[model samples]
Target: MLLELHVWGPAFSLPSIDAQCLATMTYFSLVLPKDAWVLVASSDPSVSPTNELPALRSGATWVSRFRNIVDYLRQYSGGEWDLDRDLTGGERADNIAFSSFVESRGQSLVDLSLYVSSQNYWDKTSPAYGAILQWPNQWILPPKIHAQAKLRTEHLGLSSLDLEAIREQKDREHSAAVAAGKIPKTLIRNPRETVSTLLSKTSQQNQFRLEALTAEFFEPLESLLGHQPYFLSPDRPTTLDCLALAYLSLADIPDLPFSWLRDAMRSKAPGLTAYTDRMRRHHLGLEVKVIDALSATSTSSTSSPSLPWQAPERASFATLGKTLYDTLADSTPILKHIRLNNRLREAALAPHSGLSGKESKAVSAYALARKHDLYLSIGSVVVSLAALVGYMAHIGLVGFSLAEQEVPSGTDPDPDADIDAVVDAGQVGDFLSML
Candidate 1:
């Protein structure tokens, strides 16, 4: 069976907008023959069982996330495709340590550059998302992604780079003025002025801090990769190389409005920059044609037939509604606990698709748990609605029928009498008096 790799569509002239997706793309390009596995720009995470990108599908089994995919493929091919199979035990240990370190530090830097910086996000990142996403998704996905990036990097204390945070701060200032009964003066600023203001807030201290952060993240990798084509191995690429490539490419490749991250890499870590460029030229570089999912099967003469890169799956009406619902669910403050639990459950029940028995059990248990959660949620809503209706009826907020009265001598029941009885039982007189 031909393996399928589903990922976010191409953006910024790269294979994927997401860092992990790009890494997975490079991994497959290195290990699997071109004909063995095809890439699909499914983009929509809803397609994946785990609701994540960089998903790998083999036969009926689906694996998601880059690390899980690596492990699954290792078992699936029985170590034939293991990139680290040649590594010594110590080298394998370094692979795990450095990959984690890269993810921890590199994510914040990427998030800062792409999503936190207002100008960069608006000018470059958002548009990239808009280009790949279709219809309503173009509007929804970009902001959602931006919000997620902001959330991930919230602990870094870099609110000055955040667009939403700046707005919120201004709003708070305005509200404080209003609360104090002082009329706040509104200042009209042009786009250039706005951009300048945002930049101006980045104090010299903040600039130094940013420089320190970037150096801390990149310098070690640069030293490790000195005079070597790849990290940890002089002979061939390994998982560490993939991790480094994923983070470095994202930092170096994009031409953003705020080029601090890219500039730092170029100036401070020339070796790392060269390594990224080399790997990209050799393996990470990919050309993908985005085709409409709806028209993928058309036999038109004008249509181009290809693999690896296709348009994202056009969301159906149901899919759109569900996406909207999930967005609302995420945004709702009350559902925070529920969402957290669901995520924890998924983490515990992570799929191991290479093992049939375990994979089946895990998937089945997850599905069953999700089903029960949905049923419980629906039942709670029904119960709450019933309670609300009952309360309304008791308070005479709504009209309702009462039990029939016995008729004397089997006389014909008067419709008007029934109405009167209902009115009396419903407390119409009291309700009207209150009104």
Candidate 2:
């Protein structure tokens, strides 16, 4: 039986680079039969039991969430790719601590970069979502999604601080200090109100807070990654690597505001960048040239012209029209016949095709039902199209009659009086009143 991994579709980049999606992709890439597994890019989270993505389907069994899916796959694959298999007791403890720290702290940073940061969220992340969704959903879903992210960020206490508000408070403090004739020696020396200096101080404080949170994960990671390629083991990549690589790869994303995290890792952490690069190559098969091109330092001229990670242009009205055309074609008699014939051929070659008596009759009945369904689908489509066309035509005729009644026969309307001009002249209201 084929395996299906239903994940959030790519919008901004390939394999989604969504933390959970990347982790799932990494794990499956290592162990699962690539030929037998199919990746379905799902826009609807409701399809999953838990209403979240990175869901796995093995035969009839459905598994949701990254941890659950990993556990399920471990048992399903008979422990083939289990990283914990060879770990000592101490190593297991380290693994647990590291994984927890990375999942929590690292994920928060990822969330901040992709959702909380105004530049990253609005310009890069929101548009990425809009590209994947259909009309109305494209318009509606992004704001709702962004609001939810903001709420989550607020829960994290990261969204609570307002830099502008902080600056204003600092200004008030300086003013009060001057009014009381208690100006600090530092203020006297500077004598000027430097917003930049104030902002820098606030920014440094925030940076320190971020570093403290991330150090819980990265400090251990950097120490462990001293000389080795992988995190715990020497050769095999583990779950920790999957988790790390997912966020680390975001360093390459152009115009990412929270790239300080990636910069910190690269500059401070030993072998971390190399480990993620190796993992990217090993699991994703992304070319080194492409990977390097996507890195923070690479210039536009030096970067590759195209990469698989880059999403195609967002679907336009023309694409929607094409989709409607294809949908109509699917219900046409010729396409239906072709599809039915293919199904019949597959049914004939099926395992129980040669079976006699009841089995054979059931197969024949199934094929007959399928043929009927094809015709039924086509008929329904035709009825729908006719109804739609008739309704539109009726609306058109009504609009035309209304226009004729609104305009007098002798009236030579000024060419300069366009719709906007006419509306501005109150002529539109008069015409409506006449109607």
Candidate 3:
């Protein structure tokens, strides 16, 4: 079977919208032959058992995440697919260190630029996702991603970047002013509060903090890259290169409304920026149109001359139905708790090698909760169906009647008895009374 790589759909002219997905694509392009794998911009994480993108499927086995995919390829192909096969022991150590550093520091910077910044998210990033996704998914995924990004960068203490929060604060202030009879009710927004004013209020301190964070990440990478074509060597690229390319490309390439990260990359770390541009041009194809790529999958023709880009595997109807149910559950307060419990259970059960007694019991409890959720779902469906049938019958769209009493033994059935009679509003109570 062909190796299929499922990832988030394209945005900002990149093959994959997500940084991790792009890194996984770059790694596969470098290591595997063009025919060895196909790219599918499914943009649907539900396809993966782990519910994440950049998931790789080889026949029946499925692997998820960038590192896990790399590890699987190495072991499955017996080092033939290892990107760092030629690296020395010391170089490998450097690779591990830098990859972790990029994930932690670089990831934060990207999150801030793309998702935490309300202007960029609403004006550019969120809309980009909407363009790739179908109806309800377009509605669901972007906000979920934004919420996660907020949680991830909460500790950064750069609340100035979150204009939405600032706006809410301003609204509260405006409310207080109105209550105190200080401002006219006709003035909805605070007359003095504009985007420029908001930024001006916090620019100096926030810019300093933001620039310092960028320098902390970029200065090290700039020093390491120095005069080399790649991260570790002048000629060869490794897993570290893939990781660096993912983060930097996302930061540098996208033309967001607020581009603090991009501006910092250009001024402070020109070398890394250049590297990202060069690698992107050479390895990743110039532009990715999700619909065209997906359409290409049905034909024998190629979408790109260099990379094997195809549509992602289509989700089954069952999967779609399950997603709808899950979406409903998430929207509901009680079911949302069950969904959270299921996720918590999965996290608890994911690590198979070492399980303390307490962890094992937690896993069991989670399993029980999952079972309860299943029963609840079934019960809900049954009740919903019953309600639907009853409503249809009441509205005269459906009809039900008991078998006629054994009147034939005593006399012929009455032709005047209209058992098929429709119930009218006035007679509904009488019909119930007769029953």
Candidate 4:
């Protein structure tokens, strides 16, 4: 029987690096025959029992979640790629613990970076989702997904204590305060104020917690991966390798909004980065440019000439728009300038070039529209500036009129007079004059 794996579609001009998607890809690469299973990428949630991506269906059996899917596969495939075959009693226990840690703590960091970090989520991640969706769905789904991810991240908490722990701590403090007669019971903070305070406090604390946990998570993994090509095992890859590689590849992505986690891994856990790069090439069969930390130069290696899982060529308007947006938003000054110039040159050459009549017309129209937009933007700015100047002049005239009314003979003025009210009256006069 053929297996069917449903995952979130690729976007952002990149392959799917979503943790679960990566895990699914990793599992498929390892155990299943290349043609045995079909992979489906879509945004629809109805396909999965849990309403999540990376769900697997083999015959009538349905499995969701990376670990659960892997366990089921292990049973179904008869332990063909099971890493636990060689593990000792202690090693098996350690593997389970490590997997749980990565799923909870490590996964939280990835979620925070991709969704909670404003720059990454808005500029890159959300737009990626929008690209995969149709017009009305694009308008609606991205925000909903973003909101859901953020709420999940918030609930996960910054430290080990989490939101529940913090709430419990607050309750304990309130009880102590009441016992000590520090304040009246009636003066206890209401639910609204309690929630407000918790949000305010956790906002900053969450960032600090992410930083600390990110470092803490990688330290042990790096040590374990040292000198060995894979974590725990020397020859064959394991489930832990799949989970670690999923996250490491994501963090290493160029131009990600949150770089602190990536930078930490690069600086403090170079071995982990190297290990992931090797796995990505070996299993995924893509040529990744790996930068040597000591030499500070990139070394390119080809795992396979042809990749089975490569995404098909995308040539839609959404793809073009996203490409332009990313190019324009490039932080590097020279690259941005060059990309913009190249785009303009392409637009100019399109009508004369060997493009189809429809393509030429589309390109020409886009260029003209963009030019008009630039002109309108400049005009709007000029008009805004003129209005601002006129308003400032009106304010000055009102101030002068108020001064004259206060001291007609230019004597000492009353210091206690409400100057703010006078200013408001002047503003009213200015508005009336304008009318």
Please name the candidate that would achieve the greatest lDDT relative to the true structure.
3
Per-residue CA lDDT of model 1 for 101-162, tens digit only, reads: 99899999999999998889999988878766766678777877888988999888887887
lDDT of each: 0.76, 0.61, 0.80, 0.63
Ranking by lDDT: 3, 1, 4, 2
TM-score of 1: 0.75
Worst 10 residues of 2 by lDDT: 303-312
Write one digit per residue (lDDT tens) for candidate 3, span 140-187.
888899999899999999867887788888788878888998876676
Task: Give the better candidate number (2 or 4) by lDDT.
Answer: 4
- On TM-score, the leading prediction is 3
Least lDDT summed over 10 consecutive residues: which range in candidate 1?
286-295
Cα RMSD (Å) per model? 7.9, 16.1, 10.3, 19.1
Q: Taking the tens digit of each residue's C-alpha lDDT, what string does model 4 give over 5-58?
A: 766655432235477777677767777777777655544443554545777777
The true-versus-predicted C-alpha distance at residue 244 of model 3, in Å, is 0.3
Model 2: which residue pairs collide?
none
- TM-score to native of every candidate shown: 0.75, 0.55, 0.76, 0.54
Q: Which ranges in model 1 have alpha carbons more than 4 Å from their true place?
A: 181-193, 203-205, 286-307, 310-347, 353-435
Model 3 ranges with Cα > 4 A deviation: 174-192, 297-304, 313-319, 347-435
